[model samples]
Target: MTGIGAKALQTRWFVRSPIPLFRAGLGFVFGGRLLLLQHLGRTSGQPRYVALETVERPATDRIIIASGFGAKAQWYRNLQADPHCRVWIGFDRNRAAIARTLTREESAAVLSRYRREHPKAYAQLASVIEEATELSIDDIPYVELHLS
Candidate 1:
């Protein structure tokens, strides 16, 4: 977070470089710690993809992700426009899913679990997110992808 900023977070090449690997069905390389979300564009209705860090996988069929950029993130907005989507995580690809924004209380619980389960990662993420968005972890929006 020392040198990372809002501009760095918004950099297309830096953030989206992993998407190609996910699309190629190599998501397992991420060790279940990241996922590729395939959603429809809110206005264009075209497929859009994003590689997001996995905050938690509470169940085999569910993955929780934090919108570090908050509710205004493009992927978050698109999911809100249409919850239907597909997910690629670990060795799984193209699994149908529904995205839902967790309530504040639910997000808090998930964040707590994430922090406990992955203290090092949580600390690094919290720092970068705080620097980039100027928002605390509790204020960030969390979304759950319920896979089918």
Candidate 2:
């Protein structure tokens, strides 16, 4: 259950079960915020995908996503290994986009603006982050996907 703490839920069967449906459903889940990032595995060199939330959309060709699980998340690491990737943005996907991890300052500014735009969701996310990691949302890292 959600109240079971972050670690337990992460390893539980129920948590993993939705992932398959998530991948299968792709962009249908959370409007355009949830996207299936298609990237390469760092060592295996195989294609991989992980659903991520689009926290900020400053421009039509650019989108920002936070590392909800921190910098050690597999998808974040994969992007560092290979900047080139595609985002399955529902109807029109952004292919061969450049994924750049934003600086701390940039992330802070982005989150500030994001909070104003999505006040209630931001508060909920902050609470979840605090519960999961015992840290503020500011501790997490973010990335900018520059589409071509």
Q: Which candidate wins on lDDT?
A: 1
Screening candidate 2 with a backbone cut-off below 3 angstroms (N, C-alpha, C), the clashing residue pairs are none
Q: Which residue pairs clash in candidate 1?
A: none
Candidate 2 lDDT over 1-148, as tens digits, reads: 3345455435647434434645565555567766767789999989887766689888878989988778778889999999888776655554678999999899989999989989988887787766776667898889998888
Query: lDDT per model, in order?
Result: 0.90, 0.77
Query: On residues 65-108, what C-alpha lDDT tens digit does candidate 1 reach at each position?
Result: 98998888999999999999999999999999999999999998
* lDDT value, candidate 1, whole model: 0.90
TM for every model, in the order presented, reads 0.93, 0.82
Query: Which residue ranges in model 2 land beyond 4 Å of their true spot?
Result: 1-29
